[model samples]
Target: MPKNSDITPLPASGPQNKPASAASVAMPADSHSEGGAPTSEIELPDFNDVELNNLISGVKLYLQEHNFTEFSESNLFLMLIHALRTAINTSNDLAVQNICKILINLNEIDHAGFMSLLSKKIDIAPYTGQSFAFTLVDQFYSATITRDTPSLISLNFLFSILLQSDSLFLKQLAELQASGNSEGMFGLLLIAQALLRSSTESLHIMSSELIASLVILILKKNEELINTRLFQPIPHAAFSGQSVLTFLLNVVKCEAQHSNEFNNLLLKQLIEAIHNAPESLVNEGLVRVIKRGPDEGLNAGHIFLQALIASVQIKNNKGVADLQVLLKTLSARAGFNAMLLDNITSGKYMNQSGMSMLVQALMAAKDNEYDLTPIMDVFAQIIAEQGKEKVLSALQQRVKYSSTTYLQLLTNVAKDDSSMTRLLNLLENESSHQETLNPAVNGFFSKTKSEKEAPEEEHKEFTSTHSSSASH
Candidate 1:
């Protein structure tokens, strides 16, 4: 391992000459045709170990002198990339580390340009570029495990670039899984765990992308891998008694407010996983996530509701069923109903689409005889908080298709004076009372009318009894 001093910046001023040995190396003569426009086919030159080392030395000097302006376009830059590739292929860790140090320093100079160049280079020969990237990522995992700060810093700089290109990063993991590279796949998981547990804010920021990618990848694998691997207990101290899935969800809960894309992506994968996996295993995992609650902001419960609403919108019946089961499983927990009610009542979880989905879920629960108490409670609160005008307007929009279900919900929740009054007013103001005259609505009015008359009848009986007693 190189000490910090060993990787220090070169002197501020230096002659910008290629090293003596580097002169022997072949450079692409021109990247443009006779028309003076850049050509699409620029050939990469090969270098032996000695020449590659000299080239790396020269590129290092060039970067120190020029500060990376046009560095990606320079022939020296091309040679540096080839050298790094060769070093990776040859398993030369020292050379790989040195090249990583250069790139890390380059990033400090111009982060955007550095990332742009990295992406282009990866796209040049994706498999080879991925090979190099995987090697660096594995090194990063090792450094993180051993607490090797210097190496971890350099490798994290490289790994962070890979994270920003999530598609490519995921492709690399897919390739590893296809090749039966269990070690490689496991290293990636460990890297995700480490990042999630990292205290450093920047590394922590990168954890969300890595975790989202890992989750998507794991969900795509076979059942054994999904259970034995993703659900296996994490060995880290920070993740005591938690599986990889739980730890990831915990981090996600804290980090979700920072990145909705991550939350949405993971939520989609989890919903799909629930739709596809054996009901018990996936539901168990989800129940555990919900049970732990959020370490901070948005939690798995919120995510579950979001996913459930989305599934309903898409008409993903299997996903909706699985999510509903998970919801029911958590409904009995302390304060679970209140949290859900608060979210829905505050409009945090219910848009027009969300409301329609909730209504649909409520209707299904009624048909299936599942307890609609929690959801009904949520609706009553939404009506109370948002008012009958807004809530009734929202329900009316969905009433055209399922007026029966909509009216049934109105009847079920019209258990109190204020709610019954609002329901009657809403029914009276309807443009057409035909649907409001349905059996359910008539039954609701009859039920309320009978209950109202019972109290008056009881009062008369009480007055007659009192008069009879006085006369006697």
Candidate 2:
């Protein structure tokens, strides 16, 4: 919240003194005298001088006191532009840096208006405009490394402007990535990280685009950069508490218009995180990502199922439990049942052990009161396609080594008398089925049999009643 004046001014002569003659630059045509005659050009100060800084300060003060619309047409804008051009031509880093501060202040006053005007002005000279932008980027990198918040905010504003206005800026960034410039790459990551962490609304809007672009660029050049740098924990204390993973997930959540290539990169990263990171981080991260619902280009449900399968494959109980939390959300989506059926029936998850894990997950979802109709439908489809015998045989094998959760799931999926009888007969064939089965499993089987027989009993009674009526 510090004002621009808080920054230490550059060592220069008093504001009352004009720049030396050699440092003077021509004013724009609009700045001519009242009679339409050319006036003396303004004195563009040296890097060490304060005249340009004073002019910028004057503009800042005027903007603070009056409407920015008034300043757009004012004489001060033309003078500031001429001075800015001179600084750009001379590559006077100091003056340009101060101008960045002024731009940041103007942006604070009216973000959209000032940015539009700035973009228009920069478009006048593409090459010089890019040069000016690059200077700001360099300054931004410098401020980033030094943890200069004020300057970072200012320079980042300019950087965002460049991103919005110049297409080549991104190309240059890709070039930087391709060249193996670690410093450049890291700076981009840090800037992006900083932008996401920023509380500013405009910064938030630009940050998503910035992150998407950087991720796409990194994904294209080397995915390893994402793992090593972008995903690495930020060293700054301010960002120490933030998660880059969550930021990326937010991008997925908030911006759905990204190309499939971008969405694929994000999905890949999430899957990698789930597979490699600690169980806690993976579990929590997946829940949030799945809740955000990544773009349809990549199936969030598939991602969830993959993580669920991995958790089961490794016997990570915590992972499985965490994923069960998302069952309802994933199940609510259309075609989710079909997707789950395909995944559980075809991949590594299709095996006895994998199916057992999925069964347990579904059973837990049922116990939690999450609607398992979709999952039950999947189970039915599996039985119909893969044969009830094959499905029963797999569950029978898993029941021997795992918990009775599979038995509970079997009870739910075996909706018909024949399917229930087949599963019970399979369990009965096990010599130790009685001793090994928990009360829950036994209860599930007993309840399933009675429920299946009730309708048959009612039909038999109806038949007897009709016969009695006819005899009468």
Candidate 3:
């Protein structure tokens, strides 16, 4: 939250962006099992109706006994989810509405807690209605972008669980259908529209909101605005006049049909945010993407590389720096570093400045350090493209002013059998000799000569000793 105002309002859109009707976005298919778990079993305990009834009744009694003092929203969050699942099964519209009312009440009592829990596990189904659902989503966006970490965390978890639970439910239905229950097919068809998608479509709206909140936070000048509590709106040239969530929802939904297009657009938006947004916010978001690991469906590393490559192509200095930070932050990640050699060198994304800065950053990073393989590849490519004189000059400059680590790495690259052979030839051809590079070269290339001379030197001593013995 900026110091101006901690409140941001996410305005409602027309019928096109309706939350319950998220079927428009065409989310990826559900391949996993129930509750979004990969297996058939759900993570949550299986509660029969009687047990659910007792639990709900117990909660009601507890609340009544305490004179309706609202319990901790976090504590009641899972309880509400359990109750709502029962409500979904009962198919009683009134019960669903009542559950919705409790959620709203929780929000009213503790907006932070409700927003936190809503961000985490609260589910609003048919009861909230399409319009109401959109409003709730808007509120979610507003609450999330405030940069309140606790609230944002809850909100983030909310959208994720929305997809997971809906996926799980769909998987269960799929398994049931596979079981060959033709008799119930007609009944399922009637409710299929409501049951099939569940909250997935709404989750896109949430995704849109999440992106918007981040954009808002990024547009603020104060780097530490997230930790502040002032209220601020989305004001930036990048966003134009429209708010973050609304625009992204509209654009992403329209482009949903195009597979990589959507992902590309998403990546572009994140890079844009990183260039203009708060470092902390951009960093936190990138870390999450990187942490998602490289899976087949969506690869965070690929997304990161795309961003870095774009930054280099456009010569966005800040963007490149942010990317460097990203790599350094995740440097120790073997999987990420394993791909850096190809990610950086395979494409001509880095010019002289970009490549040099990247190499220096990787070699110089204090945290999340990377191995020499990627570092070696970077300088090797630089030497090949920019010539040995250019790389040697850079190394000489680093040794002159900065640390020797850069100098040492450059020497290591030059000393490699693959790189050294060419580098030595290039230097010999150009006749550009540096005194600093001499001893390192002598130290490295002398290994074979030293090995070959050891036996001869020993033999000479043995022959001398034998001749002296014979004379004696």
**Highest TM-score scorer:** 1
Off by over 4 Å in 3: 1-46, 53-78, 81-101, 109-262, 276-303, 306-472
Model 3, clash count? 12
Better of 1 and 3 by lDDT: 1
Instruction: Write model 2 residue lDDT over 1-472, tens digit each, in one string.
Output: 2111011121223233443221122112334333221133323234324666666566566665656665543434434544555455444556667777777666667655553343221212222222223333434534433434444444445656545553444434322221112323334444444433431232434433444454444343333334444334433433432335544544433222223344445545444444444443333333321111122112334334434433333222333333443444334333443333332323222333434545644434433344455455555555555544445445543333233334444554445434444544555454235455443334334465656444443333332332121110
Query: How do the candidates rank by TM-score, highest first?
Result: 1, 2, 3
Q: In model 1, what is the error at residue 21, expressed in angstroms?
A: 5.4
- Best-fitting candidate, measured by lDDT? 1
Task: Give all candidates' CA lDDT scores.
Answer: 0.44, 0.41, 0.33
Every model's TM-score? 0.33, 0.31, 0.27
Give the alpha carbon lDDT tens digit for every residue of 1-472 in model 1: 1011011112122213446332333233433333121222544445566655666787666665554543544445444555665665555556767888787777668665554444331212322223333444555554444444445445555655544543444344333322223323434455555555542233443444544554555465544444444544444434433555654544443443343465555555554554565545553444332222222222344444444433433322344444455555445333333343232232222322334445555544443344456565565555555544444445543232222334344445344435344544554454244353433333334455545343443333332332121110
TM-score of 1: 0.33
The clash number for model 2 is 0
Q: Compared with the true structure, what per-residue lDDT tens digits does model 3 show for residues 326-391?
A: 444444343333333332222222212233334433323211222334434544455555555544
> What's the residue-level lDDT of 133 in candidate 1?
38
